[model samples]
Target: MNVAINRKLILNILLFVVMIGVIIFVIRDSLSEIFTELGKTSWPVLLGVTMFGVISQVIEGYTIKNIANEFNREFSIRDGFFASAYATFYRVVTFGTGSIVSEVIYYHKKKLRYSEGTGTSALRMITYKIALMIWALFFLVVKNDAIQRYITNGTFLVIAGIFVTLLIVSVLLILSLNINAQVLLIIFCNRWFKHQKLRDIVDRINNQVYSLRAAIKAFIHDRNAVIRVFCSNMAKLVVWYFLPFFILVQEHPTIDIWLTVALISFTVILGGVLPAPGGIGGFEFVYVLLFRNVVGKVDAVSSLLLYRYATYLLPFLIGMIYVLFNKQRQINHEFKKAKKRS
Candidate 1:
């Protein structure tokens, strides 16, 4: 346990150091410029927009809870949202796999059955990835020529191909599974993470394979829940895209909303794929490269930084607070329960 703590601490320090280095490398003397643009930003709008983002994140957590319900278990809304925020915060702290760790911790703390909690979290992960791929494909094949002006031909082509392939493969696999949740999950887990211990755990809960099937069938057969989740995610993505337009509104009274949306959305999709914490350096680098083609390099960099602050850092701080408070409350609740039992 001591070794684990030391390793985690070391990893966090390294991630922070790397993030700082990336920011320095990208901004250099432009910190002043970044700050200047930041000062010009409308705080009210930023707050409102970020709150909407947070609400969307809460919806994501609720979506997890809905998946859990299929297995006849549940988590409170507050606990679920807190779990989501902390999971995201974990990503920033660990630089990777923090979200997974956070979910596991939250599940145990919430007293959710292990099968139900892990299953719900896994389903949420799969759905989120699929949703992102869906949006990416829509942008790629449909709006390629327009959005490509901001991004490189090479990069656009690569991203588009990936989304298209994922869409095709996912559809084919789901169809082949015929909504057999366990088979799909087993194949997925085995293909990605070949852990003997995980296999053992999965084998223990093999009965829940029927529950998995039920959930998938509900997703396809019922349709409303799936549609609701899809629409909710789409609305969030739209808000995410609109940030660039709002940022530009301060400069130009009339800006092309579609272009701004396309550019920001494309850049964000790229960040989603990159192996970085909250898509930090990877996101900024993509924006710098792409936005420079359409906007000046300086402004492009500024926009990237602004969006990062509005979308990433601000949420990270809020999530940290949420996690801290939630942890205290959770501990207190547990203590009361123990006292009552005693």
Candidate 2:
């Protein structure tokens, strides 16, 4: 038991260290210019825009709360906030898996069943991804030019292709989360490929997927709650995109906010596929490269830093406080208990 705890501690420390290293590596070349832009930034506007970060947290937490209500579960709104915030911390610290793990942990600590935990987490991600797909369509209509400009950049083309492919796969996976093994086999695989071992494995997976799907339908049964959660997540998406909007707003008043948001969304989607923690290395790299084409190098780099800080770092700090100071021990305790029960 002590050995297991020690191993987790080591892993946590390693992931944190890697997080710092990636951030430093990302900002290495832009250090001077980023600082200069930070110095010149309008504090009042910047600070005001920062509030959107807090608003985003509220919406995310509320979305979780709504999901809980759908389950008739007894999770508190405060726990909802911590779940959303700390999950972001997990997402960053643990790369990306932490978000769902934290959500499940939140429920486990509340003594809720695993299905509720997982269902709530899955619902949050599904709604967010669907909203992003809608954002892509809007981008195509309003900011086609921004995308067109980057089409000639080889890096952009590669990243774009990856993003599209992942988006398609993600959509399919989410839509098919409820599908049975037989249905999946019929739609995706052939009879020739089937075997006893494979069928057994597929059946086990299908059982879990069916269970999860039942949970999903239960949530959707509360029609008003479903709509509220969906809209709340969409609002969160809007506010998050605004962080980048404020960065480019001052000198480029003529700039389309949608265009700015779309590019930011593009960076997020593209960065998400990268194999780095929370898309750290990949997000920063592609964001800087693409933004440099639109704005100058210095402004592009600086704005990227500001936007990231507001959207990522700020929430991450609050989340760490919630997890480290308030909830981490409890969640870890619950995880251990659950493991023992199994």
Leading candidate by lDDT: 2
What would the per-residue lDDT of candidate 2 be over residues 1-342, giving only the tens digit for each residue?
656665665666565566566545534542444455556778875686568777887788788888877665676667777787777776766667557767677777776677767767766777777777667666666776786677455345544644675576475456445356437554564465477887676665554455467667887778998789878878888888877767777766776776678787677666655455553478887787677777778777778877766667667768767755543465466557556655
CA deviation > 4 Å runs, candidate 2: 1-42, 153-179, 182-208, 272-280, 327-342
- Whole-structure CA lDDT of model 1: 0.61
lDDT tens digits by residue: candidate 1, 1-342: 555555555555565556556445434453445456667667875665566567666666666665555554555556666667667666766666567656766776777665555555655655666666667667667667765555446455548646754775475435434546556766787787678998887665454444344446545554666666666567656667777777666666666676667666667667545445553576787767666776678767766767766556555556667765654565556555555555
Question: Which residue ranges in model 1 land beyond 4 Å of their true spot?
Answer: 1-40, 72-77, 154-161, 164-222, 272-280, 329-342
What TM-score, computed on C-alpha atoms, does each candidate reach? 0.66, 0.71
**Displacement of the residue 125 alpha carbon in candidate 2, Å:** 0.7
The models' CA-based lDDT, in order, is 0.61, 0.68
Which candidate has the highest TM-score of all?
Answer: 2
